[model samples]
Target chain A: MATIETTGLTKSFGDVHAVEDLDLTVEEGEIFGFLGPNGAGKSTTINLLLDFIRPTSGNIEVLGIDAQERPAAVRRRVGVLPEGFGFDDPLLGREYLEWAIETKEADDDPDELIDLVGLTGDADRLAADYSTGMQQRLAFAMALAGDPDLLILDEPSTGLDPNGIQNMREIVREQAERGTTVFFSSHHLAEVEAVCDRVGVMNEGELVAVDTIEGLRESAGGPATIQLECATPPTELGVADLDVVTDVAVDERTLSVTCTGASAKVDVVTHVAERAEIVDILSESVSLEALFNDLTDGGRDGDDADSEQAATEVAQ
Target chain B: MSVRTVAKQDFLSARRSRALWFATTLFALLAVLIAYGSQGYRLSATEQVQNTFRSFGMVLAVLLPIVALVASYMSIAGERESGGIKFLLSFPNTRRDVFLGKLASRLAVVAAGLTFIFLAATAVAVARHGAFPVGVVLGTYLVSLLYGSVFVAVAVALSSAVGARSRAIGAAVGSYFVLIVLYLVPTIRITALVQWVHDTMLGMEPNPHLYDAVTYTSPYIAFRKALNLVLPTEMQQEVFRGSLEAGGELPVYLTDEFSLVVFAVWLTVPLVVGYVRFEGSDLE
Candidate 1:
C-alpha cells in the first residue's frame, strides 16, 4: 500500500506558485528522499501532505486516508520533524519527548528514545539551553517516540556533526527495516544517496525526476566509467563497434570504457581481455551530487527565463 | 483532552514567566495597602468596605487590563514567531485547540492573580473592621474578572491576527491605548467641554441622559456603573446622585443589566473574531 500519494497538488501564494501540479507517491516501508534547492518547494509539498496548509487545488492521501478531510487521523499515525522548529519553553528534553508521547497516545519510553537519538545526558537539561545540534537530536527523538507508521522529516540533518549524521543514517535504516515508510527532504545528496531507496528531485515547484540512484545517474547522462589497466595494449580492440560503450580511450597500457549501464562493464572487460591481458579494472559511477546539480542548474536557468519574461510583461 | 494538554503546557510556561509573577505580586501589595489605609479613617464598617470597593475598582480598572495584556499578548504570536507552531501543529492537535487552549490558560492566570489580591484585601478588611460584606466583595471580584477577560480576549485576538511577535506586541499595546486611555479620557474631556459650551455660550443645559449614554460606551465606565448596582443602595446614591439629580432619573439603557450585557459583548465578540481568523489563516 502507498503510505503517501498526491495528485496534481497545487499551492500558490498570490502570484508566486510555491507548489504547482505536483504528483507524488511513496510506497510503504521505503525511504523516499525528497531533494530540491532552497526554494524548490520541498517544504511546501511536505506542508501540503501534513495538511498544515490548505491546497489551492488537488487531493492528498496518507495511509489511504484523505489528508484534507481527516488530518488528525493522518497525524496520529505520522511523525514529522519540521525545519526551523524550536523550543521556546523551558522544558527539559525528556519532558518534551514525554509530551510528544502523550500527544501521540503512545507508550514509548522517553528516556529510551532520547538515548536512541544520542541525547542521553542532555535529556534532563532545559531544551532552551540546548545547542542547535542537540535540539535537532532531541526533535528526532520526539519524532521517534510513537513508533509511527510514517515519518516525514524536513531537513532533519540541518545541524549535526559527522558522528550525529552517521547515527541518523543508522536510525533511518533501522526504521525502514521495521517497515516504517520514511519520507524526508534534504540538500545533502550524499546522505540521500546512501539511504534512499528512491529519490524525487524537485525544481521550481515541479518534480523533475524520480528514480533509484543508479537510474538517476543514467538519466543525467552516461553510466559508470570503467578504467582498465592491461598487461599489453590491445591495438586490434575495435570497441567502437559496440553500442554499450559510449566512448573508449586508451592511454598507454590503460583502457577507459564508458558504459551505458552496469551490464556493459562485463562485455567491455571480456572484449578487452580477449585481445590483451587484463591486470586491474576500476569503475566509477556518477555521484548523486553531480546529477542533482546538473538537473537543478538546468531547471534554474529555465526558471530565470520564465521569471524574466513575467517581469517584462508586467513592465509592458 | 488535546485542549487540556495545550492549556496545561501554556499554563506551565506562564508560571515560568517572571513578568507575570511580578505583576501578580504588585497587584497584591497594592490591594493590601489600599485595604490597610482605609482602616485609618474613622468610619462605619459599611463605609470602610464601600470605600475599599470603590478604591479597588478604580485601581483594577487600570491595572487589570495591563496585566491581562502582558499575560496574553505573546501567547500565540510568540509561538508562531519562534517556529514552534510548526512543531505543535505537526501533532494531532488542530488550530482550534491551540486558540482555545491559549485563551483558557491566559484567563486562568489573570483570574488566579485577581483572586489572590481580592482575598488578601478581604483579609485585611476583616482584620481592621469587625465585619465584611461577602456579597459585594464576591460581586466586585467577579465583575473585575469579567473586565480583565475583555482585555485578555482582545490581546489574544490581536496576537492571533498578526503574524510576527513585534506586530502582535504593537497591536496589543495600540489597542490598549485606544480602548483604555484614548477612549475613556477624551470622552470625559469632550463631554465636559460640550456641557460647559452649552451652559455658558448657548445658555442651555446639556441632556444628562445623553451624557450618560455617551460616557458609558467606555467599558471601564460601564464596569463602574455595574459595580454601583452591587454596592449598597446608599453608596449607589452617593456615587450617582449628581447624574440622577441632573437627569431626574437614570435612563433605562444605563441600567446595571445593560452594562453587564455590554461587558459580555466585549468578552465574546473579540474571542469569536480571533478564533475565526486563526482558523482561516495558513499558519505559516
Candidate 2:
C-alpha cells in the first residue's frame, strides 16, 4: 500500500502560489527524498501533508487515511521533524522525549532514545540552553518516539556536524529497515544521493522531475566525460566531428572527450582506439549536480542581480 | 485524554514561571495588609467581616483580571510566535487539544493564585476576630473563581485569535480597558452613553432599568452584583441600593443568579469564537 498519496494539491498565500498542482505518492517503507532549492515550496508541501496548513484545493492520504479529515489520527502513526521549530522553554530535553512518548501512548524508554541521540548527560538540562546541534538531536529523538510507522523529516541536516549528520542518516536507514516509510526533504544533493531510493525535484512551486538518481541523469542526457592517455600526443581523429561528442581537447600525451549522452562515450573510445594506441582510459558519468542545475534554472542565482540582468535584457 | 497530556505539559512549564509566583505573592501580601488596615473603623465582629468582604470584593474586581490576563494573554500566541506550535502539532494531538489544554493550564494557574489571595484575606479576618463567616467566604471564593475564569477565558481567546505576541498583548489590554474600566467607570460608562441617548433622542426620563441592563453586561459589574448572593442582607442593600431604589419589582434576569449566567456566557462565547478562528487559520 502507498504510505502517502496526494492528488492535485495546491496551497496559495493570497497572490503567491506557495505550492501548485502537486501530485505525489510514497510507497511503503521507501525513503523518498523531496529536493528543491531554498524557495521551491518544499516546506509548504510538507506542511500540507501534515495538515499544519490547509490546501487551497486537493486531497491527501497518509497511511490510507484522509489527511485533511483526520490529521491528528494520521500524525498519531507518523512522526514529523518540521523545519525551523523551537522547543518550549522550561522543558528539559528528556522531558520533551517523555512528553512525546506519553502523547503518542507509546511505551518507549526515554533514556534509550536519549542515548540514541547522544544526549545522555545533557538530557536533564533545559532544552532552551542547548546549542543548535544538540537541539536538533533532541528533536530527532522526540520524532523517534512511539516507533512511528512513517517519518517526515524536513532539512534534518540543518545544524549537524559531520558525525551528527552520519548518525542521523544511519538512524533514518535503520528506521527504513524496520519497514517505516521516510519522507526526507532537503536542499543538499549529496545527502539525498546517499539514502534516497527515489527523489522528486520541485522548482517554482511545481514538480519538475521525479525519478531515481541514475534515472534522472539518464533522462536529463547531461554531459559525460572520458580521458584518454595515448602512447603519444594524439590527434582529434574526427572525434569532435561526431554528432554525439560535444567537445574534444588535446594536451601532452592525453586526449579528453566530452559527450552529450552515454552512447557517445563508446563511440569516442572506438574512434580513438582505431587511429591511435590507447594507454589508459578513464570515464566519468554525469553527476546529479549537473542534472539538477539543468533541471532547475541554472541553480540558485542572486535574486537581485538576476532580476537586474533580466530587466536589462528586457530593456534591450 | 490527549488534552490531559497537553495540559500537564503546559502546567509544568507554568509552574516554573517566576513571574506568576511573584504576582501571586505580591497580591496576597497586598490583600492581607489592606484587610488588616481596615480595622481603624471601630466595628463589631460582623461589621468587620462585612467590611473585609466589601474591601476585598472591590480590590478583586480590579486586580484579578490583570493577573489573569498577564498569566494567559501569551498562552497560545507566544508559542506560535516562537515556532513552538510546530513542535506541538507534530504530535498526535489535534488543534482542539492544544487550545483547550492551554485554557485549562491558564485556568489552573489563575485558580491557584485566587485561592491564595482569598485564603489570605479570610485567614487575616479570622485571625483578627477569632471567627469569620465561613459559608459566605466560601461562596464569595467560588464566585471569585468564576470571575477569574472569565478573564482567563478572554485572555486565552485573545491569544488564540492572533499569531504575533505583540498583537495578542494589544488585544488583551484593549479588551481589558473596554470590558473592565470603560464599561463601568468614571471615564465613560456604556450605560451613561445609553442613558444620554435615551434622554435626548427618545425624549424620555432616564430609565434606571435600562442602566441596569447595560451596566450589568460588564464582567466587572456582574462580579460585583453576583457578590450580592453572599453578602449579608444589610450589606447587600448598601452595595446594590440603586436597583432597590428603583421602587418596582426587579426582573428575574436582573437577579444575582442571573449574573452567573452572564459569567457563563462571557466564559464560553470568546472561547468558541477563538477556537473557530484557530481551527481554520494556518500555523507558521
Per-residue lDDT tens digits for candidate 2, residues B118-196, read 8898888878876587767887788899999999999999999899999998998898998887854677757667878
Candidate that would win on DockQ: 2
DockQ of every candidate structure: 0.67, 0.81
lDDT of 1 at A204: 88
Docking class of 1: medium
Which residue runs does candidate 2 get wrong by more than 4 Å? A299-316, B202-206, B237-245
* Tens digit per residue, CA lDDT, model 1, B151-235: 8998998898777989998998888776678545644464565566667778886666665565566677777777876787756
Q: Against the hidden true structure, what lDDT does model 2 obtain?
A: 0.87
RMSD, candidate 2, Å? 3.8
Candidate 1 achieves a global lDDT of: 0.83
C-alpha lDDT (0 to 100) for residue A223 of candidate 2: 66
For candidate 1, write residues A52-99 as lDDT tens digits.
789999999999999888887888888899888879897888888888
Clashes of each: 0, 0
Q: Looking at every candidate separately, what fraction of the true A–B Cα contacts under 8 Å does it contain?
A: 0.68, 0.79
The TM-score values for the models, in the order shown, are 0.90, 0.95
